[model samples]
Target chain A: MIAKELFKGTIKTIVLKLLSDQGKMYGYEICQKVKELSDGELMLTEGALYPMLHKMESEGLLKIEKVNIGKRVRKYYKLTRTGKKEFGLKIEEFNNFIQTMKLILNPSINQSI
Target chain B: MGLSDEQVDYIENLLKENGLSYPPLLEDLLDHVCCAVESKMDDGTAFQVAIKEVLNAFGKDGIEKLQVQTLHLLNQKKQLMKRLSLLTLSVLLFTVTYIFAFPIDPPNSSPLKGNAKITAEFGMTFNKLKAQNQFHEGIDFKVPLGTPVYATGNGVVTEIQSKSTGYGHMIVIKHDDHFESLYAHLSEILIQEGEEIKAGQLIAKVGNSGASLSPHLHYEVKKQGKKINPRDYLTP
Candidate 1:
């Protein structure tokens, strides 16, 4: 099980990859998707996710849209062109890093691979 | 089982009363709390109880802690930008000062003060028993064992010899007029070969090292490798 502290660093990469794959997603939907993908092992609270999203939008990596859902407005995030390019590079780098971590952490599993 | 508009406004006002005034985080927290309470009601929990549990998840500081953390991150970004700009400004100021300070080289003064004897004069036959018949290149000044020798002009040090048979420890400086001067038989050389020196700059100390009868300085000025008399160039 991955800890929330460990997920903190890769949250940007997670959002970038999610937006690239799903086109656009609202804030609640993104948190639910992360939970579902991790088999409910990882949880992203509202406090952490919103600040990261706002920071990304400020950096021009993501664009936001508002949709009227009943009486409230839901904010949806979509990747910009720069965000797409960044996602491609970040995933490749992250995958290589994960493989190196795998070798160090699970040497017996590394023998078979 | 979505929350009513009245329920959303009640939570927002409660948050505002408890010091959650940062707007963006406040709005997002309100949405989060409303959704969580609605979901709990759908699962058979009472509305007020679910709201209490959901708000409790944000801890005793409620939305205030998250707001502080987010603002801190933005402050760090602002501080990093300020430091970078300050660094660039300092570098610019340094370059301006350096350009303005460049033309003040080669101080104007005589090399030696009026206290030493002219041991050997330039351009006539000067013999010390073994050095037969040769025109002396420059005036020899007989100073004490460790008398300070100075640069006679503003120039760069062209050569230095730590131990040569002819002149024990020596330094040669090239001046602005394509003229090079030599200070030889020095007991100690205080400047490096490539260092810029001004007139009256202390360069070495006098010693007896080369073909000489007593402790003295061997000074010579040359142009295009030919020796010139230092007497025509310097006053006493």
Candidate 2:
């Protein structure tokens, strides 16, 4: 399992990517999907997930669709135009960061000097 | 496993009581808690046990802390707007009070329009008709009948009295909380009570209407309701 501190910075990128793939998802669906995709190695708490989702909404990165199911209302979030553009940039940056981290962690002897 | 309406209501009320009353945040938290409880119930846990487990998962004051954190971020701009509005209102109130209560210019001009002669001064003097010493409260200006009487300062006309006795046909103008001026022995009043008066504005005509031997204007100045000498404020 990843520590919460490490997971914090990646939440927006992950959410942007998730919404891009799934189109739209509510709070619980996002949490359940992350846990399922990570094979129980990642957990999204209500405290962490909702604030990030709301912050992104306020920043115009996501739009909400509210639906009534029986007596309860469910809020689903989808990426905005800006959010879609951000997703592509974030994915490339994250990929480059992962490659850089791998090089440092598994350094060749010639490069280590 | 889905929650019943009553169960959903219970979760909502719980979140509201714990101080998560913001509607959007409330709705999101409600849906999440219901899903958590329903998932737990699907695993064979009883309804009561499922609800407890879901709440405990949020940790202590976790629901409340979420709202506080959200509002802290959202209210940053709103708080500034509120403070600016309060400051604007205070400055407006101060400006209004300063203009009305303390005029930029003090009462300086004499209440007479032409050559003025002092027949009586403020303080004790002998009244030959009554043949006794009388404490005169105002300075008496000996002006002919139909002479114009003006307001000494910018103020509101607080009172107008018409009588055939002492200080007859008087007009009182309150300049501020600290100062008020009075004009008496007038034949005709040109302004109404509560009317705004300006300095040197002709407000009345001098007459011998009260208990007097000749036509004169009786003027008095009071500081905080106590009679003070009018000569201090009236320019010669």
Candidate 3:
């Protein structure tokens, strides 16, 4: 389980990175993507995800479009130009973080046995 | 196997009182919680117990945190408006003070020599009229009755009279640079005798005075034995 503070800061980066790759995604779709990528280890509550998405849209980092899907209107979010640039920087930072964590978690694996 | 109409109504009213509009995001979260509670009730749990479990999952602090963020955003907007209003007010105050405190400069600095023309016109004109025979000294200001009269130059107050025989309420400021200013026919005297005064320090309000016709201030600038026209040194 991810610590709340860590999850709070990275949630935006994670969403932006996913949208960068996936073109556009709705609320539920984005939640599903996070779960799948983390191999069911991460679960984002709707309570947390929607507010972050709304805040990002207000901040001009994301843009939203609404589409009618049968009985309901599904709101989809896509990265804005600024968001695309931010996504690149965040991905690089996340990759560096993952590499650092791997080194710390299993120092023996990279060293002579 | 669902929330009864009465329960849903109660929940909706509670959310409304909390100031949340039924936006899609909020509605979806509420609907999911309601469904989860209803499912538990259908499986033999009591209504109250199921509702409690649903609320626990929602977390008490989480809802409050969201509400606080909305209120904080509103408070920040109000603070910005207040700051803007204060800034505008300060600017207006500074402009008014600057206009009154500084003497109006003439279009061109032309020189005047020996007892030039001066008019003791409006508020202090009565005092000028009273002194017309007895050396008819000083120029009068044609300003509003209550306009704050300021010192003509830096000086020390020689006399400040609340009520005297000739000048009614008045002030006499003696300047270091060999000049004396006499302000008479005042509605109120603001300074004290022998107190140091600066140019543009408020000395009195304009008023009718002893042997006068109407409200006005009697202003005099004297250097040695000469009664030069006060207007020569003043800007209108």
Candidate 4:
């Protein structure tokens, strides 16, 4: 499981990138996608995911539409135009962060594992 | 089969009291947890164990962090509102005090008697005089110069003099109740030697005649000849 503190900042980016690529996704579907992408390594609890989604929606970064699926009403979230721009910026930042982390984590990586 | 309506209502009320709205996302999350707990119970899991498991999934620090953020925002708004109210109240209080309680002085009690109805009020001080130290003695009320200044309550006129002192023209009324009232920087005097007058009666008018800053009646009251805070006696 990912450390809670370390995950807070990146969660929004993760969600935004997934929605940007997938076009639209409901809550359960997004959770399933994350599980598959992480190869079951990263599991996001509903408690954390829903609040972030709601916050992003409130901020106008995401738009929601409700569809009646069988007996339940499912809410699907899609990225807005502003969300697309933000997604690009976040991806760039994340890439830089990953490179920095890799350098710090394995300074002698060029020599051995 | 699930949590009672009363429990849900209780939780909702708690959130409301904390100035948090019931957003749909939080509602959906709670509903899912409740349903999962119910399912576990149906599968022969103990109620406490199911509840513990569901709460554990939320993570101890996660819920607390979210609550703290919400509460911090609420508290900031509340503090700003409280400060604004206090500022408005202080301005209102100062206005009322300025209108009602003007011209306070030696610092003493008056033996003569008369009533002052506060006609016009303003403030005066020697701030620009470059004196070693200065303080505002009283608020000045404009009535008429030498308009027979009266005692605020029952007090005797203890000191009466006319010279180039701080108060060029002044009258000190001493009261029998160990209180004194002072009227200073006057144009003329109306009452005779040791005479008594009733409250609200004409004593003197506003004047610009003494070490006077402007044309206004300077007034003061004192308990035991000691200047008490005049603001405490004025009515709102």
B49-163 in candidate 1: lDDT tens per residue?
9988987887788477778777777777778879999999999999998767654332224556666787888887647745587788877888888888889888999899977
Candidate 4's docking class is: incorrect
lDDT values, one for every candidate? 0.79, 0.89, 0.67, 0.65
Better of 1 and 3 by TM-score: 1
Ten-residue stretch with the least lDDT total in model 3 chain B: B105-114
Query: Candidate order by lDDT, highest to lowest?
Result: 2, 1, 3, 4
The TM-score each candidate achieves on chain A is 0.87, 0.92, 0.79, 0.86
lDDT of 3 by residue, B1-236 (tens): 75666777665565555455647555544554565566788899987787777666656665546655544544566687799999999999999998777534321111121132344432233333445434557655555567677777776888777664577888777765456677888877777888887666666777776544667667776665356556666654
lDDT of 4 by residue, B3-51 (tens): 5666445434533443445465444444445565666789999767876
Deviation in Å, model 4, residue B131 alpha carbon:
68
Cα-based lDDT at residue B137, candidate 3: 73
Candidate 3 residues A5-31, lDDT tens each? 778768888889889999998877777
- What is the descending TM-score order? 1, 2, 3, 4
Q: Which candidate has the highest TM-score of all?
A: 1
Evaluate model 1: give its TM-score.
0.55
Better of 1 and 2 by TM-score: 1
How does chain B score by TM in each prediction? 0.52, 0.56, 0.43, 0.42
Q: What TM-score quantifies how close candidate 4 is to the native fold? A: 0.39
